[model samples]
Target: MKIYSKLTSLFIVVVLLGTLSMRPSEKKILIFFETKGYYHESIPTGVAAIQLMGQQNGFAVDTSRTSEIFTDEKLSIYDAVLFMSTTKDVLNEEEQNAFKRFIQKGKGFVGIHAATDTEYEWPWFNQLVGAYFKSHPKQQDAVLHIKDSKHPATKHLPKTWKRWDEWYNFKDIQPDLKVLITLDESSYTGGENGSNHPISWYHSFDGGRAFYTGLGHTHEAYSDPLFLKHVLGGINYAMGKK
Candidate 1:
């Protein structure tokens, strides 16, 4: 009986140590860049930046550049989905359905730059992005107005930030979206109509978290510490992390 009790205690210790050792790993993020529009030059840069950020932030990162995004099973495996400068109608009906289902599952999404230029025909994607790319005046220096400084993505940013990129105008944005930053048309050369332009914002749609940023016009921008932090914070938040 004494020997049996000692062996039983040893087995329990081994089982507990194995259970603790086998905790699930950190979540992974997959970035897709199927660009066919104005910001093609920035896609590779954006993907590279995301890869670096994943390493810095301790998350596994993978990437693909296919318009045929049709894996419902694979979509469920990722913590976040990042659309990097994809323009034009890429996904077919089945793929769109898969994407919709992916968001419906309460995952996260991050849209960078020309992601606004994509899925103009898909109203769901337009709202998910919080805006669509209408047109840009020209690529030049412009000042970004930080609207809500309390947002995790913009909390560390300055009130009036100047960056060089193509500014996008959106159509019929929902009033419910909490706009994080707007363009200072006065400080910029274009944006003549001065409609409410949302450069960065977050929203909960279809039971999932979404984040979009319209600032990635150049690859260099992604490497900048502040810009990287903005993207990282948005990505992390969408992944349900603080």
Candidate 2:
């Protein structure tokens, strides 16, 4: 009986050791970059940057330009979905409905650049994106005022961040959004919203997390350490890990 007990203890110890050696399951993110309107030349750069971030950060990333992957079955495998400069009405009604269901199931969403220019006819999508892109003057330099430094997205940024990108004017801005960064209108040309213009924000909506950033029009934005950190933080926040 003593020998049997010793063997059992040894087996248990070996099992524990093996369990400790195994890695935790990695979180997965889907990067959807379909554009029915204006396509961004920076999309490939954005995707590559995100892939690098995932490789370094232990998350997995999958990119898609087709809306067929928006089905709940496919989307369920991802912890979060990122709209990387998606524009115009990219998804069909069925795909849109599936995406809506995915969010309602407490998944996550991260919108970069022209994601606001997507799904104009879908009110739910509009609210999910937080606002719609009205127009932009041109790609230029602007100063971003950190509104909520406590947020994971803006916390790494200085109080005043200067960068060059295409700045967008927004319409139907959601009143309940937790603004993380605002545009300093005086620092740039073609300001429309004046002092109240939000450049980045995050909020909990419809049983899920949503984060949006108006930056990333320029390829260089993806390569900048500060901007990459900012985007990674937003991704983390949306994944509910921040």
Candidate 3:
């Protein structure tokens, strides 16, 4: 009996040590860039950029250009869904319903650049993105007016950021979104939205969180440290992090 009791105690100690050494599960995000309309040439670059961000920030990242991954089974592993320049109607009705359910279950979403150009008929998507793409002139240098500078996504940004990229005009702008940054129309041209052109925003939708930024359109954007931080901040925000 004494020998048996000693062996049992040793086994329990080993088990406890093993359990204590186990690492916590990593947070995962899916970067979906399916475009049923115009595809951006910078999609690959953007994917690499986001994957690097995940690596440095201690999160798992997956990329998919197909809408077939929208099933509940596949999406179950992800804490958030990021649309990196997805354009037009990429998801069918069934997939759309599944995505809606995913967000409704308290998942998160992050949109980038031309993500606002997607899903014009989907009201839920419009509200989630805060706007729909309308038009823009040629790419040129412009100043960004930081509206809410305290947001994790915009806090590092300059009060008046000057950069050259393809700017976009928007339609169906939702009032519920917390605008983070706006374009200073007078700094450049193609001033469609005039004094109220919001380029970045975030808001809570349904039971989930959503963040969108319209600042990453060029290949150079993926390499910019500030722009990368902006994207990372938005991603973290959507995932309910800082």
Residue-level error in angstroms, candidate 2, position 205: 0.4
When 1 and 2 are scored with lDDT, the better candidate is: 2
List all candidate RMSDs to the true structure: 3.2, 2.8, 2.9
Pick the winner on TM-score between candidates 2 and 3: 2
Best by TM-score: 2
Tens digit per residue, CA lDDT, model 2, 88-151: 8899999989999989998899999999999999999989989999999878889989989888
Q: Model 3, 101-177: lDDT tens per residue? A: 99999999999999998989899899888899999899999999899888889889889899989999999999898
Query: Considering TM-score, which of the candidate structures 1 and 3 is the better prediction for this target?
Result: 3
C-alpha TM-score for every candidate: 0.89, 0.92, 0.92
Instruction: Give the Å shift of residue 172 in candidate 3.
Output: 0.2
Residue 66 Cα positional deviation in candidate 1, in Å, after optimal superposition:
0.9
Minimal lDDT window, size 10, model 1: 189-198
* Residue 126 displacement in candidate 1 (angstroms): 1.2
